[model samples]
Target: MKSLVALNSNDPELYLLLRHILEAEGYDLRLLVDVEDLDHLLKVGRLHAVILDCTPDNESSLICARLKLGGQSTPVAALIPSDGNAQYMKLIKAGVDEGMLRPLAPSRLLQFLRHQPNGASADGELGVLAEGKSLRQHVLEMDLEAQRVRYNGRHFGLPPIGFRLLACFLKSPNRILSREHLIAAAWRDTACVKQRTVDIHIARLRRRLHAITGSEMIRTVRFVGYVLQPHKNTRNPGSDVFQRG
Candidate 1:
């Protein structure tokens, strides 16, 4: 069965509303009133998505940001009160895929569930492949099923966030990736993050890349963001980077 976790620290009434809507649709609902619970849940495995209630105190954007920083690919949907604009853009910047205001229409809610990638099996989904068993050079190859990085015929291990960030650069090679873009691509929604968090992760990635290759394959375009540059000689015979414009 598909699982959907709900994170809302302050609103029981809203929780009740979500329970009725998702349970009726046959989703296994895991209710989390506090954000800390999300940390533990994320460590276990991926979920279809996380639905967060937007409030004055606990915003969905922060939740989304932290999730991306930790490398969880689950999509996030933010529920705002039915009223004015309510800073939906903030949620987008934080890494939320879709933002809806309550009372949500049944059709729209169903559409969101149906389109989520988390429910799909691996054979039907995309994947990341590191370059051919190398960690020293800056270039990493990505495809629908694998990611590989090559350096002297050796491979380096990368965590999920590192892999996602590197893959984003491989797809865009020398182009400057602003923190906002990196966060969006890496997180796939902007209702839960801050820009500074992106910077910190980038710094960590740079260190790891340098340690392996002894050269800065990833560069910072000051006042802009980071760029990926692959080594000249190391190329995988079968992999080509895919870019989404």
Candidate 2:
């Protein structure tokens, strides 16, 4: 059984749009214009994520605040048009885990949901990772069958492209991986994002690794590509010093 999602939106077309984006292989979604079902599902811990399409009147922001008060850890993503800085801050204050603009990108949306703590998984649906030998590198442990990684005894996971990119690098440690190589390895016909998307995912992966190790894991090669290696405290005088972006 896929994980359930409760979607409540005031706009009919917006609700349908969200459903089309969210109701994928790993998710089962309930589309509701009213919040009673959402409230019940959330209270019972039956939903993984709630997508709120806020109206110009800010009804969904109020709903977001109410859900936060309900004390559920489930993520609430606000699907809204661009608002002023003040109104956007209000949405954040009201507890929107993610804010997405109009013309939603399903790939990005899926990435957000997959990384959420209580994400969906379908029945008998195996992990996206290939089952093989465990890739153990220091604090990193990859359970290929589970498609999950544990760092410092804390479990972690990433979106498909991120996972693929990390795996490609880990499988060939201490090697420079060009963006083109990564595109072939991590993204074949899967996503429509540009190669620069690899840079964003690499940056995210670097942050996660630094969180656990307190040092850089991946290094940018200036005009070249990237390379993943252990952070060296001391640097060679000939090599230029690299800083985090």
Write model 1 residue lDDT over 34-128, tens digit each, in one string. 55778767666667778776666774667777775667667677776744245555665565555665676766565566555444322222123
Which residue pairs clash in candidate 2? none
- Model 2 score (lDDT): 0.62
- Per-residue lDDT for 132-154 in model 2, tens only? 64565555666554556766578
Which parts of model 1 have CA positions greater than 4 angstroms off? 24-26, 34-139, 145-167, 178-201, 204-216, 231-245
Which residue segments of model 2 deviate by more than 4 Å? 6-27, 32-133, 188-191, 232-245
What is the C-alpha local distance difference test score of each model? 0.60, 0.62
Which structure among the candidates has the greatest TM-score? Answer: 2
Summed backbone clashes in each candidate are 33, 0
